[model samples]
Target chain A: MTSQPEQGGGQAESLTRLTEQLSRLPGIGPRSAQRLAYHVIRAPKEETRELAEALLGVIETVRFCSICQNVTQTDPCPRCALPVEDQSIICVVEEPLDVVAIERSGAFKGRYHVLHGLLSPMDGVTPENLRIRELIERLRDDTVKEVIIATNPSMEGEVTAMYVQGLIAPLGVRVTRLARGLPSGSDLEFADAVTVARALEGRQEF
Target chain B: MSAIRVTKLSLTHFRNYAAQDFQPADGVTVLAGDNGQGKTNLLESLFILATGHSHRADTDREVIGWSAAREPIPYSRIAADVTAGDGRERVLELVMQLAPRGQAGEPTAVAERTIGPSGLRGGTLQKGYKVNGVRQRSASSVGDLAVVLAGPEEVDLFAGPPADRRRAIDSTALQTDAEYARELRRYERLVTQRNAALRDARERGSTQRTEDMRLWEQELIRAGALLLGHRITMIDVLQKEMLAAHTEFTGRTGHLALEYRSTVDIAGNGGASPDLQQSLADALEGAWGRDSATATTSVGPHRDDLRVVSGDVDLGVYGSRGQQRTAALALVIAQSAYIGQQLGDEPVILLDDPLSELDADRRERVLRHCLTPGRQVLITTADVELIPAEVRSHAAMYTVKNGRIEAA
Candidate 1:
């Protein structure tokens, strides 16, 4: 016997397609996507039309930074281009949220680069999977004084930080891990603002 | 092969279901509705059909419709039809009927679940169960059918408090191993008994009577150690799967990890098996005197947590809500894959708005990696615009409004 499609195409086919697509995104699932889709369907025409336009607009306009690979509306995100910040230190992070966390601490006046992800052999994520090459290129500049490895303290976080630090160590640029006590195996985003600030202030040479 | 498909799940006088039924398509059924729209209710019916208990913690009477009139007495029932996975041409119908309102004074209500493999009239009725159908002799004797749900509340599988995460681990492990489940229940009961005995001895001021305490401790150690051992093994398996799945789900090269945080750390000085087991026993024994004085448990796997971290950062603590959700999602998806690998039958996968907190890239990665052939995946969502393009191409859709379901 053929397994029935729980929700078939004929009934809300476009809606299902949208939900399936939405569910495929980072955090939206079938249920949320369905509710959202129906929300759009049942919503006032202008609201849904605006959402549809925004969805398309974001996809069309949003692109990763050429240098940091952070999602951006511009080629090099603000941090990559801003001249007011110290260009000597380049803070490396796994995701864009880490950038926000570091920025919230107000400790570091340096520029930032987002790697998109870390290296996990078991999960098939490797150096090639992230923006390592872009980082390497950013480091090739002679004026850069330090590279802060702000990756979380998990095994994979350490591995990524170490791998990147090792690659650029020969260049004479300082590579540092965030100071300990932020809790091992925890993400940076949820760290209390003060803890993150302290981790930033206490960075030591790797 | 036929899959058990719940086309219209309407619950009247059912727990939290004020007359609700939502229709879903075959293969990948996505139930997209707001919270409290009887979403879990729909899945509850399926769970009761498979495992014979509502995942909800409420009683049968609580599930009855309070709105029903007084004359006829309110009742509850769940109905579903399945096409056999064995490729049987006939539609299989199953109904679980609850006891009438007047008969439910006892703590446990009797119910009957009838299986009609062919037609509504010809199905066999297994009695002694009330309208709700939980077996009389053993609540679990209801059968070996299973359903697994992945929801946002499970974010703790990676970052919540230890007990929250432990329950998830124990729940899945128990579902698979009956002996493991029994041992867990026994261990919990014995821990209480041992603690009470220690308290009693202490109140009587009998330190010399510690031998009786030792006897209870012995039982505690034996049962507690067994529980810890199963947990250790489960964590080991979960770690390997989590690592592989994290990589696959993120489509990046990041290591995924799972480690059991026991009450006593593994002794670094001794060999693997003997020392670890002894340390666990010691911890459990020590907790009896020390923790009982304080009226709490301080040692054993019950205090342990399975930490899901990526790199050096815990996905639960440092990662964004989105990241934690992804980690949790990966854990469940990987568990399903592992279950499929270990047990040839791919268990039905239930995802309740799994992608609600994720961004676009991570969402697509989950679908591409997690949902595959021979697996029945049920997904629910609230936004149609957030879906990625590829996923939209493959799934069938439906709409649910005010508990009524129809093909969209």
Candidate 2:
């Protein structure tokens, strides 16, 4: 019984191929992959074709912006290509997804620089692996007066932000970080003591 | 009074038990069996379920059944149907799977295997915990089942090294207070990361090592202060209860005291005042030179000890074997009382061959204290005669044999 192949292996070649590829995705498990394969099989041909085209299209067309290193079809991403309203400020982030998040808030109309990754020495992700050189090169022009480090509030994220701050500060650019504290709509009772303490310490007057 | 009780316990591939289910009685449940008949294993299953780690076994793989050794992915699970203090029933389950050593693509496995090297022929142990079928941190699941285990090795707690005493206090505090558990985890992680940073500095002789060390020290001080604060507060509470318990059990005129001994000077305006965090931070800063030279943290709660004393004579150092055992029992009993008072729920007491070392009178005293009304207790023994006739008569008795538990 241990030596026998799976019962449906012979008849499920296409399904198996699709499931294997789906399972390789970030959040899709083997069971979810199988479910997704079945979904694709039952869906209309046009829907599956569109899905396949969108996946391939991303890989075929998307390239990192020459200036900010954010994924974009144009050499300079739209954020960098836009007339810089706040040319003196550049908000640095850890990933292109973070750029989307910050942009969604519309709180900052300044330029953006994507690091692509954070500095995690334990995971062999260093400043060399990230686009730190590119960020420093942008800072060398000295047009940006305030570089806002908007990395995630995590150990690796903080370390990367600090490393970038150290590099950019030598170029006379004032470096700042996003405030760390409690999230909005979260009760103080539910928040952990550390977050509460930080929130209290970083409190501001209305 | 409300109490957490185990309504049902089931084990699969755990220790000597291939598969066993037990419905322990509310007041007192006695497990009678000969040695090596899975008697202690039954108590151990309850302990692991409550604490998320084994009290007897050195490694989780040691708890996996021998028959499972040949399987590709050997695993063991212990599940309990626990009724919390509010009468809400939740199933707390702990599953430990043995994976092939050096397996990649699993980061959780990396942290779980920090218990030195695995002895199970290249099988690494990975544990998963669930409360009411929802995946959760093992430490968080401890809130579901609180247990105070008084076993043979507990006697060593008073007489043995500081680590044993620390474990006793930390485990009990962890079950009762969730914040303490989280701080302990954060403190441990910070220590590991700081040590790695120290090692990296030593290897490279980096000039920025001091700056890096300072940053790590600040974070460590923050986490360490919380841990030290919790441990000291817990020790104060345990001290009072332990004194009460010692007097009740031994009926001795001598006074019993518990002191929280720390490497850092937590005296005067230190631990007792608002300057506790400042004191800890100052101590870390002062020790930076020495710590940098040694490449290890020199002062913190990790280096602290719980000193048990009777009229100025330390029980850990000067007490006789029996006296030490009694002190250990008193401490365990105090922990149970402490948990009961703090959580408004009495923790289930597990006595694993606790009477074997005590004299008849002392054993009776221990049993009387444990068998008090409104408390759930489980006692495992090789000889049924060791249990008092009064307890034997009122208690539900089960005989464990060959990995099976049957009502006697």
Candidate 3:
């Protein structure tokens, strides 16, 4: 029953290799990786081919936008290439995902500049590691009147925003943060004290 | 006054308790048990539900039962069903699980391990909080089930370090005022980050360190001023109540006073006045040289202390044991009253063998004060007689043995 080890070893090795590769992705554990590998093994040949092609296509074509550091297929992301209707305001974000989130809101018509990461000294993420140089260079044109820091509300994010604010303040551009709102449908009683206090502070006359 | 009570409490894998359920009475609920029979554990579970932290144990792992620790996926949970002053019922739950450590720089062996269906592979711990079955931050869960715990540790309020006194006052303030809690949390984060930045600046000796330190100082002053303002106001209210409580309990003719000794001179500008922020900023700026040398943010509310005095003598330094205990008790009682006055709700009081350190007369006074009408009181004692007869007659008593509780 245990004979034919040489015959079975090739396929087992491939499955093991796929599982190991999948496990290297963030949030994918070994068990999840194994399950995904087995699913892929059972998936249609065309589907697997398509998945592999998509992964390779992304690696080959996608690049950071030269203007805003956002991951994009074009040199200047679509947002940067837009007409100069709101050339006076540029919203700064920590990552391309943040740009997507803001775009989903549809409330902001201004352009965006993605920093790609926050300033985390403990993590050795210094200001030099981020896209701050490009941000300051964009401000040197004197056309941007407002720089909105839309970084996530975290310690490192706040530090990065403040650091960028301090850098651009001398350039005569007003800096603002995205208003923190009470999450919709959340009970005022259940919201954290900070969020509740901020919501009250920023309340509008309904 | 609105009455806040814990209607039901359930514990699983918590200290000394494999599984236990308790339905506390509206009035006095007595937990009578021998030593190590989970009496304190029962009280601690309720306290944890209210405060999102344990009074005795520093880490959640310490609160997990030994037998539970032997399980494949070791975890401890404390849940309570509480009725707010408005009669709205809510469930607060805290689950602490042992997991592999995920902090950076840790050895790869101690890093995130595959949490299989079987069990966790590492021994580090993490805690999760839930309110009404919905996940929430620990701080946000506070005040949902307001509680005032007076264990034997209360006696150390006056005698213990200033940090303890600050914590006692901060805990009460956080429960009463949401604004104060927000400011306090922000101030704590500012202090930690500022300290880290200070250490980094000192190590690098960069020219930008001065400007960076100045920016942090400005933020610190803003946050620290708010914290100082809240603490000062709270101490003022607590001082009056504490004095009254001490007078009622001791009947001795000495003035009890509570003073907030802030690192910054709040009195000069009348306590967090418009000018106080500037004053604090200036003070922090002046301290930058020393802070840089020390590699720590040294001047802020973090270094402040609460001073308890009687007849101009500092209680922490000069008071006798009995005097210290009475002062501590007075502070606890005053805190309950303060909460009632501020929040319009009387917090549920949990007393764990507090009568042990007091004389019979003092014990009777404490029992009367705690068993105030409409306020829920849960007391744990080994001897039933330790509780005054008047309160005992009205109390719903239970006996705890071998980590089990039943009606007595």
Best by TM-score: 3
Q: How many backbone clashes does every candidate have?
A: 98, 0, 0
**Predicted complex 3: CAPRI docking category:** incorrect
Off by over 4 Å in 1: A1-206, B1-12, B18-24, B44-137, B140-143, B206-216, B265-269, B275-277, B388-394
Q: Across residues B118-162, which tens digit of lDDT does each residue of candidate 1 receive?
A: 111111222222213322222231113345667766644566666
Give candidate 1's iRMS in Å, 1 decimal.
22.1
Fraction of native Cα contacts kept in each candidate? 0.00, 0.00, 0.04
Off by over 4 Å in 2: A1-137, A140-206, B56-58, B61-74, B98-126, B206-209, B270-274
lDDT of 3 by residue, B138-186 (tens): 5335557777888877787778877777778877877877667667877
Model 2 lDDT, residue A138, Cα: 86
Candidate 3 regions exceeding 4 Å error are: A1-64, A72-89, A105-110, A120-126, A142-145, A154-159, A174-176, A182-197, A203-206, B60-77, B84-138, B141-144, B207-210, B269-274
lDDT of 2 by residue, A1-206 (tens): 11312325674777778788886776444555666888999999999999999999999999999998999998887777889778999899989889889989989989898888875434545456789888888887768899999999876676667678767777988999999898898776556555776798899999
Local lDDT at B292 for model 3:
73
Q: Which whole-number lDDT from 0 to 100 does residue B333 have in model 2?
A: 91
DockQ of 3: 0.13
The candidate maximizing lDDT is 2
True contacts kept of 2: 0.00
